[model samples]
Every structure is written in structure tokens, then in C-alpha cells.
Target: MNEFPRMSVRDTFARDWYLFRLDLLLAGMPNKKVAEIRKDLRIELAQAAQDGEFRQALAGLGPVNVLASNYLEAHGRKVPRVWAGLVAFAVLLYGWLLGVISLIEGLYSAADQIRPDATVEVVRNWLFVQARVVAGPEGVDSIGFSLSGWGLLGWLAVLVIVPLICASVWRAWLPRPTADQAQRA
Candidate 1:
């Protein structure tokens, strides 16, 4: 039998971390492979624990642990096909929400153009009528608000900038692995 290489504290922690993610990826795979990988990782973790290094390494990996836990909880029960379908459904739902909001705004604008006395009730009724035509019985009365040109521009800016900010924050939180670390995995 081939013996695995002895791993230092840091190396062991990194290995275990990667293996945990791998296990999640392979959750629905064969039990034999999962057990084998878990056994190996436990052995490494045990050795690191004997030297008090496992706790230290785990302290440094708090963020990674949180991320991994969230990922597994969100995705573990889902196969790739189901995961993709769920994502598509979410996207479609979001688009529909935006379309409905846009349509309501458009109706309010149209009502304002036609009836100078475009009270909130007029906009609400107009939206309800148009929504009934498009969305049938599912349509409900919605509150509406108007945006000034600057306010609309500000909203647009937020829509574009929020994702960029989130991407930057994510990149900062998880630094790129060094070349050697990448190769080790």
C-alpha cells in the first residue's frame, strides 16, 4: 500500500479544506469514494490536532468555513440539472418582476398623459386593469410612485454599480491562491 506524504499543519489544513469542498461537490457520488476521502482527511486532521496546529489553522480559516458551509447548505441536495433549473427559474422570476414594475410605471405615465387628474387611484386602477389583461386573475392592485429624471438616473447607477461593488468585495475577501498552492491542489 502506498503511504500518503506527511503533511505540515498549514498543508494539512489546506488539504482538509479543499477535501471538504470536494466532498460537497461529490455528495451524491458513490459512498465508497466519499468514505475513503473522509477517512484520509480525518487522519490528517487528527495528526494536526495532536500538535495543536489544527485549531490554529481552523482559526485562520473561519471565513472559508463559513463560505463552505453556506455553499453546501444551499446546494448539497441539488443535482446539476436541478441547480441549473432553479437558477433559470429565479432569473425568469426576477425578469418578470421587473417587467411588471415597468408596466405599472408605464401605465401611470399613460394615465397622467390622458387624465390631468391622475390621482393615485387612477394609476392604481389603470395598473390593475392592464395587469388583469396581461397577468389574468393573478394580477393585484399595486402602489405606484413617480421618479424624477435625476432619481431615475440615480436608480440606474445603483443597479449597475451594486454588482461591481459586490464583485470587488468578493475578490477582496478571497484572494487568488498562489501558483504553488494552486499546483498543490
Candidate 2:
């Protein structure tokens, strides 16, 4: 019989603990059960180390340990898919809200220009004056004033609604882990 060389106590224990965690995750064990398994595995590995049989035990367990690790890795990829969907939803919703605000502002501007009391030049001058008043000279040449009633409303709506949406979605998607799960991790 070909015998494998002995692994050190620390190395054997570390490998066994890592494999045990992977096995628990792959087995879809409940959080409490996983914690229990981990405790038991630690005790067993410690005893095996004292008995000088740690490497022998690990060699026997190696194939199943590798399989469990692979399985857990495969399942882990699904978490990123959920996160990606959340980010895409947030970006699209923000863009849609901004588009609505822009459309309303454009309509209001057009109506202001068409009023009986206003000429095109008068409306243009009024806009320039308002922009300068809000932004001062420095911003006049940049993006102009963004502190209009519509702009304020848009900013307030985004600030209020985005956090509420995110909080609600997070609660629905990810409930708090149980104490046992937290302990295991």
C-alpha cells in the first residue's frame, strides 16, 4: 500500500474546517445544523490531531470535500445576479423620473414663451436673469442655475423616493439572517 505523507496538526485542522464548511453549505443544511456540524467537525479534527491520525482522516475525506467546495461555488454565483438586477432597476427608475421632470419643465417653458404678455426676447432675458440670480457669475457660463421650482421638486422627489424604494426592496429580498446562521459564518 502506498501511504501519503503526514500533514501537520495546524494544516490538517484548517483543511478539515474548510472542507466541513463547504460540505454544510453544499448540503443546504439549516443554519443551526451547519453550526452544529462545524462544532462537531472541530472537535473531531482536534481529537484526530492528538491521536496522530489527522492526515489519514483528511486523505480519506478529500474527494467529497472537493465536490462540496465546487457545489458551494456554483450556488454562490446566483447572489451576484440578484445584485445586478437591483442596480439595473435603480438606474432605470432614476432615468425615468428625470425624463418626466424634464418633459414637464419643457412644457412649462414653452407655455411661458407663448403667453400674450411675453415676447421671445423677454422670456429669454427673464431666464438669463433668473439663472444669474441663482448661480452668480461663475455658474452662468457653466450649467446655469438648477434651483428652479421644478428642479427643487425633482431633487426632493428623487432623494425621498429612492431611499424608500431601496429600503423596501432590501427588506423583501434579504431578511436578516438568524443568529445561528450568523454564528456559523
Candidate 3:
């Protein structure tokens, strides 16, 4: 009375690989939707295996990313893309760093106006920007500035950069441009 469904090593491997890639592509999707997808995929894999067209079935489904995107779009979900977000974050952070370096340099140049005897010196590299404003003859009343305030960058990441990248890359809030619209631009 021991009856279990059987699958060959090749079928098992193919099924596992397909599911694994699908899982990765569908990460951050809602759990209910994921479960539904898993169930559907399992049934589809079994049918494909029974028909001896498992590989063709997988191929017909197309790339996992595209399949996942279709599934998500079918469900009306707008998921943020990790690669797009990362690229946006990197570019924004670099810009912020440049701005910080420039501000530090400006402050250093204007140090003399803050105090008659103030002297400015760069104490750290541009990437991890830092400077000191010595306002007294013997290093007294010294002021320091650095890339210490990450809140601006953090806010940009959360509020502006990531969202813009997601929207633009995925066309989340915009309809796909028609061929005529593209030609006009």
C-alpha cells in the first residue's frame, strides 16, 4: 500500500532548477500569490513530464524573469526591481558624496570669515570626507565636518531614487509607449 509518484533524475533536476529560478524571480511577491504559483507550476511540471515534453514546456514558458514579470503583471502587482534599485542607489550616493566633498571644500575656503585666526585642513579623503576648522591659535574651539549625516542619502534612497528607478525601469505608473508615441519623441 505504498504508492508514491515517481520522477526520473532528469525530470527532478529540471523541475527543481525551474522552480528555483522562478522562486528567485518572484521574491518579495505576496506569499499567497507565491503559493498559488507553486501549485500551478507543480501541476504544469507533472503534465509536461507525463507528456514527455518537460524541457520544451520549460522553454515555452520563456525566461524565468519574463515569466515572473508576466505572473506579477497578471496579478496587477508592481514589484521593485533589485538591479534597478541598486543602480539608482549607487548613482545617487555618488552624487551625494560629490556634493558633500564640495560643501566641505567650500567651508574650508570660508573658514577665515568664521574666525579671524581660523585655519582649515583636510583630515580625510574625499570619499570619507572630513575637515577641521581650527579657530584658535592653539587648536582651541576646533570644528569638524565629515560625511557623518547619512540621513540625506538614506532619505534619497527610500523616497526618491529607488521609487523613480522602479517606476521608470518597470513602467509601473506609466502605460507602455505606443510605437507612434515613441516615434514622436
List model 2 lDDT by residue over 67-87, tens digit each. Answer: 455533443311222333456
Residue range with the least summed lDDT across 10 consecutive positions in model 2: 132-141
Q: Candidate 1: where are CA atoms >4 Å away?
A: 1-24, 55-79, 116-185
Which residue runs does candidate 3 get wrong by more than 4 Å? 1-5, 81-84, 89-124, 129-185
lDDT of 1 by residue, 41-115 (tens): 567666666676876644544564454444334433223222343444456447646776777767655544444
Model 3: weakest 10-residue lDDT segment is 118-127
Q: Indicate the residue-level lDDT of 131 in model 3.
A: 56
Instruction: Write the residue-wise lDDT of candidate 3 on 76-131 in tens digits.
Output: 54463554655676776678667766765565556645555544453544444555
Candidate 3: C-alpha RMSD to true structure equals: 9.4
- In model 2, which residue pairs have backbone atoms overlapping below 3 Å? none
Better of 2 and 3 by lDDT: 3
